[model samples]
Target: MPVDAPMPGSYGVRIPPWLAAEQATLPARITDRTERMRMVNRIAARNVEEGTGGPFAALVLDSDTGDVVSAGVNLVLSANVASAHAEVVALSLAQTRVGDWNLGTDPARPRALVGNAQPCVMCLGTLIWSGVKALDFSVPGFEVERITGFDEGPVPADWREQLEKRGIAVDTGLLQEECSTVLEDFRSRVAAGTITLYNGG
Candidate 1:
């Protein structure tokens, strides 16, 4: 006989209190791409400092008006869920706010997902299925693995081209230095035994 299904609230992710407070105080619109990325980097660094999760954060924004649709940080360690990566949380939150799963259904008003670092293989799949039109990120997956000692999985060699082929604009190297700094700090903390590096078996 098949086992009973798990309870509805047994597993779920949540935006940590610090991140929620910051999200509430964001401006109505950002307008500048650099500024948008800067915010993401800051959030990533703060996530490490707060010991909520890994040094990663993401935002879903209205590509046209620069309105922040939703913000999310990696909640894997905090929520005890493996799939709580920043990209997944951000995209899921965006879908919830708009009352639809397809974020790019309207071509005119597309949404963009911005992150402090490149998505791992799992998150890459989530980004494609989430219907976001554009992806902007800083720090390459290889560099992230090198700095933080987390397995990013086998991201495709031509991941950018694949996204482009699917009509998703890929913008890399946004605030690279600043983003790398956050990852480096996380590494330092992990070395000091102050942060837990959660990697799959």
Candidate 2:
């Protein structure tokens, strides 16, 4: 038998062309912190009950205006590809909308990222490369591994320190109980063998 099978079909993320235009016209900032956090959390929660990618969601926001530019959920298992991660999808869409891919730069008003769980290494690297100055997450990485039974890969003990060094500010522990519930649901599904986390075995 062949060692590997061909990918069944195309899998990726794409936002409509009009989205970028829409984002450009958004008001230049949101003053309400609670409103902004709630928006991110609500979107994150939506994907948990019924959406793509396990139980994670992510968003890219305009740091100055607090307007949401792009958002998506983890699509690895659903898309049968590793790049379909929530952060990957969201960042890509945000860049696509802006067309510069440098939205994360600009010391005056860099972009911001929010995710339901701490980003995996691939996403972390993307965040650094993408130039986002601020990151907010609801769940810690260790908790994901402890509760979900999947190896989180080689994230250093000083992950936060590394980000801080790069001028990326991180906020943790928002909506803890709600985010953990999503993690619990993911573990339950994995335990029942309802989904194979990945194809490589």
Which residue segments of model 2 deviate by more than 4 Å? 1-11, 14-31, 199-201
| CA-only RMSD, every prediction | 2.8, 4.6
Estimate the overall C-alpha local distance difference test score of candidate 2: 0.70
lDDT of 2 at 53: 51
In TM-score terms, which candidate is top? Answer: 1
Write the residue-wise lDDT of candidate 1 on 112-167 in tens digits.
Answer: 99999999999999999999999999999989988889999988999999999999
Best by lDDT: 1
- Residue lDDT tens for model 2, 94-173: 88878977775567777888887888777888888887888888888888777776565677888899999998898888
Which residue pairs does candidate 2 place in steric collision? 28-65, 29-65, 30-65, 53-74, 104-131
The clash count for each model shown is: 0, 5
lDDT of 1: 0.91
Q: What residue runs in model 1 are displaced by over 4 Å at the alpha carbon? A: 1-10
